[model samples]
Target: MALLDNGVWSKRFFSGGWTDSALDHPVVEPATGDLLGMVGLATAEDVNRAAARAAEAQRDWAAASPQRRAAVLRRAGELFTEHAAEIEDWLVREAGSVRAKAGFEVGLALGECFECAALPTHPQGEVLTSEDARWSLSRRRPAGVVSVIAPFNFPLILGLRSVAPALALGNAVLLKPDPRTAVSGGVVIARVFEEAGLPPGVLHLLPGDASVGQAVVEAPEVRVVSFTGSTPVGRAIGEQAGRLLKRAHLELGGNNALVVLPGADVHKAASAGAFGSYLHQGQICMTTGRHIVHESLLEEYTAALAAKAEALPVGDPAREDVALGPLIDRRQLERVHAIVTESVAAGATVAAGGEVSGSGYRATVLSGLSTDMPAWREEIFGPVAPVLGFSTVEEAARIVNDCEYGLSVGILGDVGTAMKLADRIDSGKVHINEQTVSDEPNAPFGGVKASGTGSRFGGAAANIDAFTETQWVTVRPDIADYPF
Candidate 1:
């Protein structure tokens, strides 16, 4: 097996230091049955040290002028563009994302850096001078150490997006990347930040699995915990954060619903769903796992969607022609397969894709879905689509809103009606005449209800809160009220 080790950066170069070894996990290439590498694990002590270093660094880094801080972020953006192809290759090899998806993710990361760089220039402070010689001013200050926990699906972009805003806003960061894709993606990030001249101890990369994450969250030095992962895991992190009383920002699993109206373009909706649902093997949290198709077009839409799923070419993710690929690992593949198979056995129709080979499973489509079925209730993080037919818009809305998970939902109909219904959906994001993959960095992306807490990638207001705290200043000057 190839041995991929942790990469730590300091003073514009790799520190040649290693995180404390707590064991190791094997990284595997799912399609070829080849072992990619093994990564050294990090213990609770390592987390504590990283967090303390970040806190210590934040004092000086936050003192820098906004323009100076933004310059570093902007420099990182340029570096990302210069190494786009190299970054994309790492993404494909490590995360098993299709070439196109990996490219898109890289571009998104570059754009996010530019967005975050511009955040500091926004006029924040307010100064007031009164006849009574009273003065007041308010400003935002960095929150010191922040611990970032990333998911494997979009390892590079999702994780670094949080890191960018936190760092650009003057907060030092300790990033705990997902073990599945940590080697290539997280290492690339560390290298780029070092090249951009980030100060030592300001940014640290911790490579490990779930236990490492728990250590980071429990550390007192870690003032903030920003996590992206499954809903259950997010909940666990939230509970731990509550016990520690540290700020927690979570982006969790989404069983996104798509409503196809009677007058909708059944062909268009089916095609969109087929491509959207199976992207990254449907490991994406915002993927459309549940379909609420109109009863009138149920047969036609279901058949069309099944055909689309069958037509998709699944192979190695590194190839440009391959449209779909295997799930990240055996555990994920087994979990997703079990959910679909059990749903079918519980009276849900298996419209397509019931076979599995090795870690690769066929892109599946299920029709005649009942609310009681596992496919309907669970967030099957795989390329399986279960569709329930609805008679009217109200019925579709009811079915879509019934779920406790509501991160995103799509409306497949005339733009006017879709927009109207989008307002009622109990989800963090709504797509009109589009799929769930259409995410904009300027818009706030997150969930409602049990999906998650707080938000990411909206604008300065949404992200500023992630890394900064407000300070209130007041001066009496010469005259003061004597009410007290």
Candidate 2:
């Protein structure tokens, strides 16, 4: 409620404190198309300053005892839970998330904090057998400073997912949240850690647009860059990081597929598909963009799915009964509508809903899709599910792998058959009898091929290595034994 002071929000944090900029961008609520407030934009110079401070703080923070670091993170998790109500409200207003989605995002953020707090005590090194009479051990060392660039949708969780782990691993973090949800993503995150007694300059949140994000990525002080967003942006970041020889971790876009086998329960699969495709208005990277059903069950599954999609309540997020909220902004709304219209013209059938009402669009089901359609090949980050019929499991696998994105896939059928087919699917994750939109704090979450850059973000092992470098140490009992 007090996120904006006098209709303006600050962009600087931690080392820089609350600083203003020459230009400010308006923050708009998607549900009503109203301007909530304005957030100051950070310049490239500000990014350099934050990165420098983070590098400086990281040395002392890394040298501190693991218990000390864990204590701060645990306290931050507690603070996050204590302010859940305000954070939820901020998420609804900033990201256009419904109550359920907003609450889930906040809960996930807190869970990440707690989970990452335990990383310090976890196994971060190993003792290796050496040929010589010396002790050889490999340990993980912090990468000095880490830069995290989060997207607009689910900003709170995604931002914290990378930030928490990097900090827990002894690296100072510089978080640049999406301009759309700066309050929920950047401000709230910084406040939680600051209140938890985190040392000054250990964490910094810079709220701005693409320019600021690029600045962070190009900054020499930032040794590791973790980003979650569209694939085009991720690719650019990966290329830039490679050119600069900096470590990059990217969680990019996905065109996930949900396969309904012949023996699958049509009604159950339909419900799961509806939730997977429409949750958060289908803005998630793991949203089910394609629905491939066996030819024998295509009619039954399509009808059931259309009914479920048609029944979802779409309106302002503030309404308790509203099951779906608007897109992030007018541009997203227009782009979604255009995708549906173009697909329909290309011989795709709109099975359920296709019209855009208010700032929100209806949950739509499209059938009779061809591989040539844009919706079939591209990632449709909207509440639209395209159903395609496959003659066999082999055909289904082909259809699923035809696209460039292979983030995740859901299989609804016999466990044995699903597991067998999952091995052939070119995805990073496979869910049996479940939806594609699934994630856990302790599981390795990422994608392969074009969906991502093959860099994982979750799980203790993955997080620790993602933000750290390996160092090998050897000790000899006698100095004369060494070749001096």
Candidate 3:
């Protein structure tokens, strides 16, 4: 099934529709190393054009009645569900996501759309009593044009998480999807909004690389920039947006840790750890990269986790029985293998699968890892989990918070102890008795410290503030009584 028109993808989507560019890049299916299609690459001029057109559309979209906007968004959500099957297939091929991962991403994205639809009608302003005979209120207004740069991992969900809210809040959006998964990330998104009767020029889609992304960020027409990707690139985008004095909401890299406290069910914690560490081949930013177990339970927990990891079926994503799929490309595969190799050489022992097999790597588990190792400190973004031992709750908290990235953490233990330790951890989110790979449409999701820029997205009220600016308004009926 060809995803693009005549097997060719468009680089631009404006008020008019999809437009092809002269320069295009090939998109390869990672599972079979097959050519899926070609995605048009956006140039600097294309980014500027997209921004200008989005700005033009923002005027009308922002002026539309809240009910009208909400209606359109609700329709879009319905359309997304209607086309879930096709979108899931695209996601599997274009992003190398397995069946479960693809389904979760699409489902979450659909929920985001529906959730954002209600945002238009939600209370956006507040009234406050003033000391003088003046009524003070604050109104939330759209930030005009927003630039969304999404990563390859969970592209659809991440893209729509910001895009849907921006649209509902009366902001025109210019989305620059990662070129690798343009079909799932950019094309499918534009199709849903178009079919839902969104007016032209309101939502623009551009598929491109870093240069094109930089163009969108630097463009004066784009009032806000929201990005989800690696920390290095996010830092560059944030710095540029800061220099330009533009609003930037960033969800970046994460080295999330999953902790198993003493007296916790070893079997249950192992199952959750296995799922969190290897889901989507550990491509998710919130994937459990480090497994911190109480020293009392380390041996048993590692044994159970190793058995689970070794038993997971790894093969092509298209296969129904395969639990794990290929990496996005050979480079990622090599990087993952290198991390495993280096960690093992640095006194870490591989407790489970470690070798690269076929198009994917084995679900590898390493034990006896120190904080000095790169595998423990860096964002692996792979199916490798390094297990570390801690004796006390304080020690566990220290291990979890020692990492530079503080996106999320998973704790499995007594509820009271878990909550107490969670409070001590420096992450933005903590999941007790659950894995780190969790998300909800109504939950405020983002990271802290090096993981992100401390901006939250996903909740109804929070999204409005993220995509819009607040203006304090005060009405004084007796202006003549003032000092003037």
Question: lDDT of all the models against the reference?
Answer: 0.79, 0.88, 0.88
For residues 290-319, could you state the per-residue lDDT of candidate 1 as single tens digits? 888888988999999999988877778865
Q: What is the TM-score of each predicted model, taking all chains together?
A: 0.93, 0.97, 0.97
On TM-score, the stronger of 1 and 2 is 2
Compute the lDDT of residue 232 as modeled in candidate 3: 91
TM-score of 3: 0.97
* Model 3 lDDT at residue 253: 92
Write candidate 2's Cα lDDT for 1-484 as tens digits.
4433433345334344666676677778888878877777778888898888888988999998999999988998998888888889888977999999988987888889999999877888899999988899999999899999999999899999999999998999989989888888888888788778788898987877678888999989999999999999999999999999998998999999999988899999999999999999999999999999999999999999999998998899876578889999889999999999999999999999998978989999999999889878889899999999999778888998998998989999889888878988999899999999988888899999888876477898889879889999998898745466
**Pairing residues by index, what is the TM-score of model 1?**
0.93
**For each candidate, how many residue pairs have backbone atoms clashing (under 3 Å)?**
0, 0, 2
lDDT at position 403, candidate 2:
86
For model 3, how does the per-residue alpha-carbon lDDT over 174-271 read when each residue is reduced to its tens digit?
Answer: 88988888888988888888888899999987777778888989988998999999999889888999999998899999999999999999999999
